[model samples]
Target: MARTTSLSGFPEWLPEERIVEQHVLDSLRRTFELHGFSSIETRAVETVEQLLRKGEIDKEVYGVSRLQQDEDSSREDALALHFDLTVPFARYVVENSGYLTFPFRRYQIQKVWRGERPQEGRAREFTQADIDVVGDGTLAFRYDVELALVMIEALSELPIPPFVLRVNNRKLAEGFYRGVGLTDAPAVLREIDKLEKIGAEQVSRNLQDTVGATPEQAEAALSLAAIRTEDTSFVERVRELGVSNNLLDEGLNELAEVVGEASRRAPGKVVADLSIARGLDYYTGTVYETVLVGHEQLGSVCSGGRYESLASSGKKTYPGVGLSIGVTRLVTRILSRSMAQASRSVPSAVLVALNDDASWSAAQDVAGQLRARGIATEVAATAQKFGKQIRYAERRGIPFVWFSSVAEDGSPTHEVKDIRSGEQVAADPASWQPPAEDLHATVLRAATTDD
Candidate 1:
C-alpha cells in the first residue's frame, strides 16, 4: 500500500501503483519515438543565473552548494536544481549546437523541483515528460500544430479521462493587449492568466490597478480572452472585437492555422482557448495548456509553448515549439481517483511447486523450460506443502501454478492450474502458454458505476 510520508512535497507510490506509472511512461515513450523525437537527459543542476534568465521563478529555485566550504574557496559559481526541462534544454542546445543537427527534435522525461505549496495536483518534486523541436534559425509555425497533435495522441493512449489541449498565441494576446492600450503586455498577460483562479472581476480590476488599463481597455482585454472555438470561426470572432494591428493579423493567421489543422486531424481534442496566457515570460509565440474534462479543478495536467529567443548564440538563434506532460500529477490523479490499476503486483505468471528437497532440481528444470518459452515462472523457495505454495502464489497474484510429479509408469508429468478459475490441465513446459493478458503486468481501467 502507498503510505503518506513526513516530507509533504514528495510523493511515493506502492509497487502496484508504480506499475500504472510505468505503463503511462511506456505509452508516452512509444508515441514520441513514433514521431521521430530522440531522447536526451540534461544534468539536474544548472547555474542559478542560467535558470533565472528565462523566467521570474526565483523563489521556487532550489540552490545547490557544498555544506562545508573552505575559506579560500571562491563562491563565483552557484548551482540550482532545474524547475522545468525547457530552460535546461535551451542551454543544452546552445552548448551542443555544433554537434547537433538543425531542427533537432528531442524528448526528455525527468524529475523537476519547484519550491511551491504542495497541493492535490502540484508538488515540489515531480516528473515532466517534454517533447521539443528546435530549429537553427527560424522554425515553421506548423510545428506548433504538430506538437499539439502529438501530445493529443500521447495523452489519448493513457487510461485517463478526456482532455482538452487549450492553445493560444502570445502574439495574439500581446497584439490584442497593445491594440487595447495595455502597454505592458506581459503584465497584462500575467493578470489575465489569473482569470480562472481569481475570477474575471478581480482580473479586470487588477488590469486597471496594476497594468494601468482604463475601464474600457480592461473590458476589451477580457473580451478578447473570452473568445474560444473549436475551429477557424475564432478569426471572425476576434475581428468582430475590432482589434487590428500588423502583429494581431499575424497572430490571428497563425492561430487559425493551428486550430484548423488540429480540429481536422483530431477533432474536438483541441480548443482555441484565448484565455490561456501561459504566465511564463519565455513564451513569445504559441502556448498550450491542457485540462481533464471533468477534473478541471486539478489545474493543467500538461503545458508548454514556443520561445523564439530562449536559446541563441552570439549571431545564431534557435527557435522552438514544444509541450510537456505532468507525469507525476497525472499519475497521482489516476491512482487517487481509481481510474486504473495494475493487474497484479508481481510479473510472474506461473509459480512452480516444489514437492520435496530431492525434487527441487527437477522443479528448477521445469521453471527453466517455462522461462525459455517466454513465460515468467518462479520456483518455490522451499519444499512446502502444495496448499501453502498455492497460497504464496495467491498472495502475489500469480495466475498459474505448475506441478511436477512421477506418473504410474514412472514417466514425468506436468500440470498447470489457473488459481482464479480453479481449472487444472496437463501441460508441456515447452509449449504451455498463459493467456495473452497474463504474459505481463497490465494496467486495467477501473469499472465505472452509474451515479
Candidate 2:
C-alpha cells in the first residue's frame, strides 16, 4: 500500500492559517468599506467567448469541462475560469449597467484560476484582491490617482515595510516606442517586459531582432526605462533625454498629474517608472506594479493598470482603473521568511476540560459561560485524565484550561491553569475573565534579519 499526496497548485491551509487568512480578508473588506467601495461576487464560470473578448489573457484562462467522468463526448467548447477578477467584473457591469451608479466603486476578493505552470509565488489557483471604479461614459482621472493612494494607505497598515508602487502609462510606452522609431508599440512593450528575466543585453538584442530597432535606438529606450527617480524631477529628466513627441508629452503630463495627486494624498508611495510594461493587453493608460522593500527579487506582489473600456454593449461604455494585490503571494513570502507567526493553533482563548465522565456536564457549563462572556472556548469531548487533557490544551495552544471540580454535594467549582507560566488558580466559572491581551492570539515578532 502507498500513501497519497495532496494535489499541487490547490493549496489548503490548516485552521490557524485559515484564521490568519480570514483576518487579512476582513481587514481588507473593512478598509474598502471605509473608503466607500461596495462589494460583489460573480459566478465562477463564464462563456469562453466572453473571456476571449480581451485578447492576450485568454492563454492563461482555465476552461471548465467535465472530463474525468465522460471523456468521450464532453463539449470541448470551453467555459473559462477567470484568470483575474477584472474581466468578470467588466462583464458584470455591462450586464447590469442600467442599475449601477456612475463612478461605481467596488471591491472584490475572490479565488481566480489560471492554467500557468506553478512556481514559488505563481499558482494555478490563487486569490486576488481587486478594487475598481467604473464610470458610465468616461472615468475620471482623479479617481485614477485616488485609487492608487487608497491601496497604498491600506497596505501600509499591514506589517510589511515601505514598498515601491512602480507606475507607468501605456500611452507613455506607446509614445516612447514611436519616438524610438518603432511602429508597433505593444510589440516593443512585450520585449521590454522581459528585461527583468532577460539581462539588458538580451533585451536589447531582442528589441533589435524582433521590433527592428537599431542598436542605438534600443540603447536609448533601455536608458529611458532605467531612469528611476523618487519625485517629479523624473518628468524633466525624460523630457531632457530628448524623447519629446506629441504623444510622449501628453503621456508625461498625465503621469505628472497622477503622481502629483497621489503624492498629496499618500506621500512617498507612488513613483513614475518608464520600465513598467504590464503584460496585460487592455491597460490603455496608467499601469502599476508593487514591490516589497528588500524583496524586489520576489517580483511584483501586486500589479494592475487602467483599462479604457472593459464592458461594451454597443450602446454603452465603461472605463475603469484598478489594481489587485496577490494576497497569497504576500502571505507565502511572510511565511517563508518567518516574518510572522500565528500565536495559536485555533481561535480558542480557553479550553474547558472533561476531567472525568462525571464532570462532563459541569465542564460544558463552564465552556458555555466563557463563550457567553465572548471568549472562544471548547469543552473536551471525552473525559480524559487531567494530565492528558492538559497536554491536549497545550498542544492546541489554548493558553488557558479549566478543570471542573465537583463540590462534596456534586455541585461544581472551577480551577484554571495558564499553561505557558505553569500556574494554577482557583476560579469562579461565571466571573473569571482572562486578561484583555490574552483573549485572542496576537501576531508575535519573529527573528529579525538586518536587511
The 10-residue segment with the lowest total lDDT in model 1: 69-78
User: Which digits, one per residue and each the tens of the lDDT, describe model 2 over residues 84-183?
Assistant: 8998999999989889888899999999998877766777888889899998889878787887888887787555556888888778778977887888
Q: Which runs in model 2 stand beyond 4 Å of their true positions?
A: 1-5, 68-77, 264-268, 408-411, 447-451
lDDT of each: 0.92, 0.81
Provide the clash count, candidate 1.
Answer: 0
Question: Best lDDT goes to which candidate?
Answer: 1
- Tens-place lDDT per residue, model 1, 233-342, is 99999999998787888888999988899999999889999999997899998999999988999899999999998998898999999999999999998988889999
lDDT of 2 at 167: 84
Q: List the residue pairs that clash in candidate 2.
A: none
